[model samples]
Target: MPDGYSTLHPAMHGMVNIGVRAARRAGEIMVRHLNRLESLEVIEKGRNEFVSAVDRLAEEAVIEVIRDHYPEHAILGEESGASGDHEYQWIIDPLDGTTNYLHGFPVYAVSIAVAQAGTLKHGVVYDPLRQEIFTASRGQGAQLDGRRIRVSKQISLRGALLATGFPYRITASRTDTYLDMLRAVLIETAGVRRLGSAALDLCYVAAGRVDGFWELGLQKWDIAAGTLIIREAGGRISDFNGTDAFIESGDLVAGTPKVYAALSKLLAPYARGL
Candidate 1:
């Protein structure tokens, strides 16, 4: 299957090839460390927040394999910064939903995206516990465990299931943004879910499991790959104010064409300057 895909595309072939292998290997490292007592030993990164050694180890494990498999590809990881010299850069989030992982809530994932010359070319997001892997190449669309998937055609926010995450570390009431976002979706959508992993949330949108998503104060590593996955799966992604500055603004809104427009209008008042 890998070889078959490699022969079918050229611009993003290396990304597909390396992403699958790296995400799987990273999942292995994560699953092997699960439920172990030592893993729950966490250090405070902020008020009432913590990061376990597992997060660091997992990030290292994923980055090491990515480096070994494609020595030329640069990497920008959540736990680690950039490295390598190739034009192709891999954006990685070794452990998204860290709090959930530590609490055994089971909503974490490892995301890997490869971009060439600043544009996303391909990517993968692996949910180790469920054993589901979502992958996408720039124009090839998104897939889950090798089956193609897409965003919902839901045209109204009132009927959609929305997703979001809270941003911590820099300020108090970090959950405030999530709370506001939650309120916005709840009053209209069928439901709002804080699954704890922004990466997987985007994948869920890509797979049509969720109709839309929005968040404030997220890093590139959290949504870079997932952004491409959602976009390729027939979803629209833009800055909260409907600009193309998602990478810099750290605020993004995404959904199907119709769903996107609805969500955009709802979010417009809050994203005025950004």
Candidate 2:
């Protein structure tokens, strides 16, 4: 365990510790299989969405840990569907950025979050390539490798560097809508980046690496951990309509309060009727 783990909020110490362990275990599986892509079995979940053997193995690793310590806790994982109906649910994205991983891009991650009675309580996002762990508990501030972190203080959109992602299923209507939002932000901000991992993008926002981020069509496991981390790091996240239902809507815009507000305003016209 890292020294920062010692500084976690006392009340959430157990859950955070368990989440970190599970994430690291899954991350290890990803790292071990990262270079051996030729043997991996890949499946196309949808038009452009993919899953691989590593995803299943990593997800199993995560679930094994959770089940070992908390058998009654439910699980909602990307590779595996939901299981065990319980008040305590663990949302797991065993391997985020699978496409990047398969291409040896070194941008993938393991994300895990625990919700108690429908409210997010603890979250962890581990980038095994960099060995960086971003974590947060409901009331405790967010941290990176044990050091506290916060969103960028940039107050204006013109000077902010933003991140976003294009949906996998790019229908004609979806493409036009996404492009409109992209163009609006591209013209106003320092630049826009598509990192292919929403979990890491939100962690970047929490760590001040990027000023803000927005994307549509993300899953619960993708944004669950990252959103909680962002909030704990003095950031705001919301759906296109500036509401707190982003997890349900899967359209999120997150950043420092000022940047979030400005970014949302910029995309408002394009998001009308969404």
Candidate 3:
């Protein structure tokens, strides 16, 4: 256990432990197969949506750990789908950046989050390539490899680095709308990055590597863990309308308080069907 675990409440600590265990297990599987991508099987889940044998194996690795420790907890996984029916649900994205991973880009991650009664309680995002583990409990704050982390204090969008992702469903009706918003942000910010991993993008916000992040068409498994980590790291998150509906809306903007407010203002028009 790390020194930060000594400060977390018992239950929260246990959840974090289990989550870290699961993420590490899955991450190990990913790392082991990282060099053998050419031999792996791949499938297209939807237009531009992909899955691979590595994703299935990693997801099974994660589910196995969670099931062994908390058999009754429901699981909502990207590869395996949902299992069990309990108030406690574990959301798992065994491999968050599949496209990048398939291309050997070294930017994917294993994301895990435990939510009780629909409220996130504990979360973890582990980068197998970088060997970075980001964890957070609802009120226990966020940590990066045992050290406390916080969002950047950048107060303005100008000169602030931002991160974002383009929805995989580029042929959808809203692609133009999304592109417009991206253009606006790119013109106003110091730089904008498209990392292909929503989980890592949010973790970057928490680690202060990026001042803010926004994205669309993300699933619960994509943002659940990272959202809790950001909030606990002294950042704010919400839908384009500035409501607590981002999780359900699949559209989110997050950053330090001031940066969040600026993003909200810039994105509000697009959110309103403009």
Candidate 4:
């Protein structure tokens, strides 16, 4: 399996062989592009929609490493839409926070996920600035730089610090969905933060830095990789409506079991139904 697809869930042999190699390769390229000395060309796809040359270069680097090994694996990325022809796909955010990167905010990351038959099996979220790497494989639990990590054990929203992300495309059609959630979390939780980077937001949830996270109008690239990391870290994830429609609808909430329940209740008022 040149693309690492044949390794599937990793047989103890391929775990270190393929997954680690791909992740380290992606991280290397990420560092190369994010050196901050390169001439970054920021382009806006919409009002706040941003893409940069670094994004494309980063994606190309990841694509090459993944494709060279698994030419059959499909790839769904932010800068480059979708490609390849395989049942298993690699979802990626070459640069998870282009805005933050452009502004030198030191909060961007590279998120990578592998899914088979639409089920996420493995994920990697790397923060180049911190050189921190988070990884997860189905039933294997989550790990940060090879050490196991788990979500916080917080039991209630009142005691939990939560994270969230709002779509830059928040038009009139989606305004209330954003504002209502913000207000609900603000009133019910200890604190609320809009980190702008969905990947890091979910990573924080998995790492226990934040007890919970939710967002509306996200894409696969934004949450796919981080979602697996959360689940494998002993966290729970669901749509705003408490369904497994996070990927399909791009509406999601994730946290430790207790925090998720509390936050879900707080968000109930604004959700579709009672």
TM-score of each: 0.89, 0.95, 0.94, 0.89
TM-score leader: 2
Which residue pairs overlap in candidate 4's backbone?
2-69, 2-70, 3-69, 3-70
> Residue-wise lDDT of candidate 1 within 114-218, one digit each (tens)?
889998888889888887878888878888877789899899988788887766643445455456656777898898778989999999999998999888877
Q: What does candidate 3's lDDT look like per residue over 1-274, in tens digits?
A: 4434532435458878888888888888999997899999999999889999999999999899888989989999988888889999999999999999999997999999999999999999999878788999888999998789999989999999999999776445678788889988988899999999999999999999999999887898999999999999999999887777878778889999999999889888876772
Per-model CA lDDT versus the true structure:
0.80, 0.89, 0.89, 0.79
Best by lDDT: 3
Residue 83 error for model 2, in Å?
Answer: 0.6
Worst 10 residues of 1 by lDDT: 1-10
| Candidate 4 structure quality by residue, lDDT tens digits, 14-94 | 432354466556656656766653477778998878888878887888888787778888989888898877888888888
Candidate 3 accuracy as lDDT = 0.89
Tens-place lDDT per residue, model 2, 183-270, is 8999999999889889999999999999999998788999999999999999999998877687977888999999999999998888
Query: Which regions of candidate 4 fall more than 4 Å away from where they truly are?
Result: 1-20, 33-38
RMSD each, Å? 3.1, 1.9, 2.5, 4.1
Q: Which regions of candidate 1 are displaced past 4 Å?
A: 1-12, 38-41, 170-178
